[model samples]
Structures are given as structure tokens and as C-alpha cells.
Target: MTMSLPQQAPSPQHCLIGPLPQLFHGELAAYGAALAVADTSAPVGTALEAFLDGPQLAAALALFALRFPGAHPKALASTWSKLYFNALLVPVLAASSACGWCFPLAPGRVRFLADTDGAPLRFVLEDAGAAHPALDSAARLQPLVRNHLTLVVDALATQYRLAPRLLWNNAAVIAEETLLQCQLLMGAQPRIAADLHFLCATAQWPDQLANPLHQPTRLVANVRQRQLCCLRYRLRLDFCADCPLDCRQRQAAQRKLA
Candidate 1:
């Protein structure tokens, strides 16, 4: 008699932001290398522009906008601008990071919302909910908004093991700051902006440090199958060089020994 073995379930696959990251990393590296070789007196704006226009960064921003449909394009663009200024420009100009390779810094706000059917929807509370009557259009969109927000928070938690409090704090701070800035510059009222700001501000990164959901780490989907499932991302600072030399060098030595 022949015995049969039980079949195992197929594991779901994930796709990380691939080509974009590679492109950005390569471009930035090249620019940095060129700067290193050139006279220190060379203009800095050229290198800065190169980094900003790098294929990877542009692709990443586009991907981000597509991934979170609930976010407004203008708002997304603004967030990217802030991120570039804060994470890249600030660090590089300040000469903070080791290779001067500033990681992409995304402000902590900018989220997503989905309809009841799981389709993505854009939601922004401009002027404390007064300027945009659409935000309060109906109660029907609440669940979608909540679910989208939850998915994004959960995803981040899974990826970074970020503390809930820290995530919430960061989100609130960034959202409020961004919204307030928008209100002033665009003459936006308080209600919608404030409300929207509050929602994003209060959103906490889901607690997934203990048990994470089974999802692809690099969440890749075909063009047709892609759903705006992710919302908000922070540029991961690659501080390997700036990191304390003790542990890093020790680990290197250990690897050589092994």
C-alpha cells in the first residue's frame, strides 16, 4: 500500500518597491561619487537636482500615489516635497549621514481610505471639515476610510515593528503640521482641515509586533490587480556608516572569523 502525503497550502508572495529603489540608489550613489571627485567649489544645486530627479525617487513617489488613492495628488506631492527637504536636503546639507546618502524621508501623515467594497477613495478634511463639504458627504465612506487606515497602519507595524505610541505621535504631529501649513498657504478654513488633520493625526500604527498578518513583505501586484492597499511611508534612514562603530565592526569581525 502506498501512503500519500498531505499537500501544503501555497504561500502568498510579496513584491517590494524594487526598480524604483534600485534606480534612486544608483543615481544618488553616482551623484555622490561625482561630487566626491569634483572640486568642493562645484555647485551643490546640480547634485541636488540630480538626486531629486533620480528615476527611482520619481518612480517611488508615483508608486506611493497609486498605492494610496485616498490621498490627493497635490497633497501627496506636497508631502514628497517636505520629505525631500527634511530627509534628504536637511541631512546632506547638514553633513549628518556617513555617505551623505540621505534616505527618503516621508512626512508621517498622508493616508488612504477605501470604500465599503474595498475600493480606494480620497478623503481630506480641509479647513477643519468646513472648506470641503465632500468629506462629510455621507456616513457611507466611514468604514472604507477606517479599513484603509487600519491596513496601512498594520502594514507599517509588520514592516518596522514600530511602537504604537511612536507611530501615533509621529502621525499626529506630521498631519497637524502639514494641514495647518496648507490652510495658511491656501487660505483653507478650519473645520475640514482640522477634522482631516485629527483623523490622520490620531491614527495609530497597529500593534503587530507580537503577531503579524500573513502578507507579502514586498506587496507586489499586477497592474490590474493592484489595489491602493498601502498608505503613508517614512524614508528609512540608512545610517550604517554613522551607526556606532562598536557593534558594526564587531559583527564584521565575527563574520570574518566564521
Candidate 2:
């Protein structure tokens, strides 16, 4: 008589009953991304536009200045922008690429919460119920890039007297890093590659307008080099390892190795 093999169990599937999937819990918490809760001890957050327009921006910068004494105001704002992008983009990009879900991440719908130390505590979305499937990069991130982030970038660039390209470069780094982490965790999700290309490789957005995030970095001898300097060196007194301004030595070293 022939022996029969046992049947294998079905692979687990993700269902979006709430703001995030179980797979994303650790990643979201690491980035301080959270859904709004009724009993949160976190302070009430300001709408993104109001935060940019009101005294909230000044207060935030003041807190950042206190935290990093002697740093120039522009450098303070640039560093704060990096923190803000990290809190906002990591979860949004992870959810979008891994699960095909898009949060209504317009500035008005999002809020920034702060800890007692006045650092970013959480990025809260008011309505995760409005999420929908987005199969392409534009469908996933247009409102986020065009409506929310672009407005904030322009405001910060004007206020700080910094280059808008540098601010966009900061955002591009955050987006690229977030997608890289997601791919590492979930394997090669095609959407991640497509989104990365749309954000970094293409010079135009899906609408054919200029893509502010396009070609934010270049790869030389397998070493990634940023196209624009973020000026964090002003704060930290050292250039980032992959910084374009500081990459010549790294490139030379890599060339020797090859």
C-alpha cells in the first residue's frame, strides 16, 4: 500500500481591520507612528498646516535649539525635518508598499505629537478608515509628496533660507531608507522597487511635473552618494559616511578594492 503525505497549512494573509497590520507593529513603534487614541497622554497635536503657520513652529524650533545648544537655526530646522520625515514616512511607506494600503496623509488629516522633552513622540493620522489600495507610486504617495511634504518643504526653505532641493533630498533619503527596511523584512516586494524608482530615479512625477525627489543620490563603486548635502555636518561637526561632499575618499577606497 502507498503512504499518503499530510497536507500543508495555508500561508497567513494580512487583513486591514485597523490602522496597521500585525507585521508592522515593531516597525511603526520604532518610528513613533501611531493611530490616534482617546486616552493618550501625548499632548494634543496641531494640524500640519496650522503647525507650520502658527507659533507652534517657533516653539518647536526653540525646543530644538535648547536641545542642541549653539546650532544655527537653519541646521536645527534641517535636523528637525529629518526627525519629522522619519516619524511620518516609515510607517506610511511600509504600509503602502508591503500591504498595498494608503493612508490619507494630507497635512490637515495628520498631527504631530511631542514628548515631554519636546521631541517627536508620534505621528498620528486622524482617519485610517479612509485607507484604500494603491497599486502604483503616484496612487500611493502623490498627496503625501505634492500636498503635504512639498508645502512643508517650501515653508521651511523660505523660513530657514535653505535650498528647497536640500530639503527634498532629506525627504528622499527617508523614503529610500524606509523602503529598504521594508524590503529587508518582507523580501523583494515589487511595489517597493517601483516606488523607489518613482521617488528617486525618475525626474517627473506621474502627472509629468518635475519630481523633486528624482535622482537624489548616485551609486559609485557600490557606494551610495547623496546628490545634495543635508548640512547635518553643521550640527554634528562631521560629514555623513555617504555624503556626496565627503564621498571622494570613499569612492577612491572602493575603486582600489575593485
Candidate 3:
């Protein structure tokens, strides 16, 4: 069974806490048109445009962000971009490609990866059982997962000028714990968020660095094409597509079963 999300919508006071939705809608529409041109047999563009204009994309992104705090903002944006483009955009562009494009017809599982530097990335696919062994140890992995997510959320709050009141209570302590956990899991001494920021800015592919506290980051994953495309971000980690960490446990279970 699929996991159920909390039914409560964002309070009116919290509505403006993250990135705006218009940015994603416009990008997805453009991407859909591009896909349509490639597939001569379908009117995928029109369908994709309509889907993007609907509420599904917004809802999906919001839910994913709320669910997975560990996902890098860039990764979340890329994941969402791919989902919107392929599942909703491409299909509407070329229905025949639906089978090929929709590797994850339903919400897939998510996994979080953090290097010694504290840069976090999320991996998502239909099954987690097929994932690397390091991803499967629930007892050992759960704390790290939680810590990564808390840090992302904290970083996002700092970047966006979002008030602490908008986040869950006790966010700072939670974030600190997360940082510690990431340090433990990676077997590296933890650096202060400020120090990590310096490292991220100098990195060759800074976008791959998960530092929502500094500026927005972008990442791309081509599940079928094996390409990595960058997605745009407004608020540091505001987009939902990049929040693969939210789906990690579920993906792990699914992959284990498979």
C-alpha cells in the first residue's frame, strides 16, 4: 500500500514559506513541448500543458517537500521535473511512449546519500530492494535519514527567510542532531554549516551540493535516458522533485520485496 500523507494543507500563514509554483509550471510546459516535437506521432505538448496548469504538480511538490526533508533541493526539483515531464508531460505529448517513459507510474521509493562533506543527494526509483546494500540497513540508516532531512529543512528555512514558526517546533535542535548523525554515518568529523557552505561554493559542481541555506541548487536524473539534467530552483530546496529522501524507506521495502 502507498503511504498516506497528512491531510492538513499548509496554513495560510505558511503558504509563502518556500518557492513559488509558477516557475515549475512554466518549465514543465516548455519541456513537454520539447518532448512532443521529438515524438512526431503524438500531441503530447497540449496534454502536458493542461496537466501542468492543473493542481497535481503543485500538490505533488508540496507533499514531497513536507515528507522528505533530507532531499537536496536540486535533487527534489529534478525528480519533480522528470515526473511532471515524463508522467504528466510526455504522456500527454506522446501517449505511446507512456509505457517506456513511466518507469514509476506510482510514487517510487527514495534514498539519501551524504558524502563526508555533508552534501546530500537523493536517489529514487521504483524498487529499493534493488539498491545498494548501504541503503538497506534500516536500523542503522533511519537516524541518518532523519538527520539529513532535518538539516535540509533548516537550511531551507535560513535561505528563504522563513520563520521558525513556519517549521516544526524544535527545528534547530533537530537540525543539529541531523548534522551529528550525518557525521557519524559518513565517518567524518562534522563541519559547521558555515564551513560546509564555503566548500560547496568552491566545488566544481556546486549544484550537486545540498546547501539550501546558501542558495538554490539544481540536479537532474534521467531514469530512462541515463542522462543527468539540471532543474531550476528558487528557494534553496523548495521544490518537491528533489525530495527523494522522503521516499527512501518505502523504496527500500519495495526493492527488498522485489
lDDT by residue (tens digit), candidate 3, 76-106: 5444333322222221212111111121222
TM-score of each model, paired residue for residue: 0.26, 0.80, 0.20
Best by lDDT: 2
Candidate 1 CA-lDDT value: 0.29
Better of 2 and 3 by TM-score: 2
TM-score of 3: 0.20
Candidate 3 ranges with C-alpha deviation above 4 Å: 1-60, 96-225, 229-258
Q: What C-alpha lDDT do the candidate models reach, one value each?
A: 0.29, 0.68, 0.29
For candidate 1, lDDT tens digit of each residue in 1-258?
A: 000111222112111121212222322332111111112343222222232334533444566565456554433443333332222221121121111122122222222222222222211111111112334312222332243334434433444454433333333333333334435544655443544433443333233121111111122232111111111221221212212224565456446434
> If candidate 1 were superposed on the true structure by all CA atoms, what would the RMSD be?
22.4
Q: Which stretches of candidate 1 lie over 4 Å from their true place?
A: 1-145, 188-190, 193-258
Rank the candidate models, highest TM-score first.
2, 1, 3
Q: In model 2, where is the ten-residue run with the lowest total lDDT?
A: 1-10
Question: Cα RMSD to native, each candidate?
Answer: 22.4, 10.5, 20.9
**TM-score for model 1?**
0.26
- Residue 48, candidate 1: Cα error in Å is 31
